[model samples]
Target: MTIKKKSRVTSLAAGRPPTARKPKSISRKATKALINTHHVLEKKKAQAIAKGDRAAEIAIESEIDALGGIEKYQLASLQGQRLDRGGDSSHILMEWLNSMDSTISSSAGAHLKMLEVGALSTKNACSASGFFDVERIDLNSQSDGILQQDFMKRPLPKDDSERFDIISLSLVLNFVPDAMGRGAMLLRTLDFLKQPDTQYSSGLRTFFPSLFMVLPAPCVTNSRYMNESHLETIMNALGYVKAQSKITHKLVYHLWVRKSGVQCPPATFKKTELRPGHSRNNFAVVLSGSSG
Candidate 1:
């Protein structure tokens, strides 16, 4: 019996599993390769999104969310810099205009008058934009022709003082939070714009005078007011032709021109309340970190 028991114990000892080996750690090179693969996938996905691929967009966005959406992905990218979407439209506008025309020349450039709403400085206004005169205005800022009242709270520019050939609405539209308010704000802005003065040239091919406007990207996509199609339709109805458009992650810049003879489409937001304070108030309360 003892011999039999000894044999059983020996068999059990022999059957016992060899010491388990430790799992291998990922090598630094392998880890880098994995990360590179991920970035490659994301780049492909981003390219597809640029081409308006919805599926790719969703996939990438999901990954962005998994990796902490707001932190991992920037809203806009330009020349290796990240920009706050809707922070400024002037740079985008400058790039777009530069693509078509050279910077402002002193003699003829004087004929081009520009208006910059929420304008902080004239730095990129006239010279960079190829404009003759640039009027910088902010809320309640009545010094040196800078209207000092809120765009919605204040009265319209007294007489022809508020008119301009080009109006930069950079980052302004996004201020208004409500959908209808945004639409109303847009309509009201139109009132300040004048048809480009074609009186200079009589030829049919002469530069058709038009209003040039630069606004935020969300003006088309975000809000309850409408979608891109509706915005285009509305602008078209107003007799404004979309002459040019540029979209960056941070901002959207577009040129709108009203032909001399075209009648504006019947105004939809004519009676819509210009919630002048709504946008400002919302930002003031929500984005308190924003400086004066």
Candidate 2:
């Protein structure tokens, strides 16, 4: 018999402190569900491999996809979300940040006017966790030094004339449950960038800003993670280009820039094969030739 699935919003509770344990318990439940499904699939995958049943293996892999991204969605939907996405993601992000230090320092004329969406009510918003100056904004969390508003709702920063120097979305796209929702967020993210009209040849623009998007592994199919390699393709369709990219087992990361005089109609992708070397945990950073 088919069983009922819990709604994503069911994992959340209202009017609770960020330190509340009941909500954490709810997240553990979601994590448990994902772990059980993962173990079962691992066994089935091994069995299929032994029998040389490739089709069976593929089918079981499809079943595993159903549980994919749920752990992250639950975390994003839970209380006291962190800059690290509640696991080892912080280590990978730190390395990525260190790699950027020289680049950021050399861009002499560039300045940072940054904003971080879904920045939880934690003591350190994602950027500040690493001591960066990004301002945090969260609709559901209490504002520390950051703003509190919904990105898709009546957010104060949603104006067409308004823009920032940097916008960061960390492990946020996967939490969206549907393609349209994810697309909507992507478009909205673009809206906050300075328009390309004033873009600089070797520096930043007058009003437009760069973007950094971090996606979790085991991502839900057809979600924003599709932009990993096809970022230029997707962003070009949106009048933007990929400024940079870093893909690993833990995440799909990108930096984007808007194109001058380009206005694009919406583009849609129905399916995509995820990058290989499946992540062992939601936040593990697997070395290129090494498994986590």
lDDT of 2 by residue, 148-229 (tens): 6677774545553456666777766544434455656767765666656654444334223556677754442233234334
In candidate 2, which residue pairs get closer than 3 Å at backbone N, Cα or C atoms, i.e. clash?
194-207, 194-208, 194-209
Clashing pairs in 1: 140-148, 140-149, 141-148, 142-148, 152-276, 237-265
Q: Which one is best on lDDT?
A: 2
Candidate 1 Cα misplacement greater than 4 A, ranges: 1-88, 99-110, 125-130, 140-147, 153-162, 200-219, 222-225, 260-292
lDDT of 2: 0.54
- TM-score for all predictions? 0.50, 0.53
Q: Which residue segments of model 2 deviate by more than 4 Å?
A: 1-111, 121-126, 129-133, 156-161, 199-208, 220-232, 261-292
Listed per candidate, the RMSD to the true structure in angstroms reads: 21.2, 13.5
- The whole-model lDDT of each prediction reads 0.48, 0.54
Query: What would the per-residue lDDT of candidate 1 be over residues 125-193, giving only the tens digit for each residue?
Result: 344554446766775342355655456664666655556556666655554434455555555655566
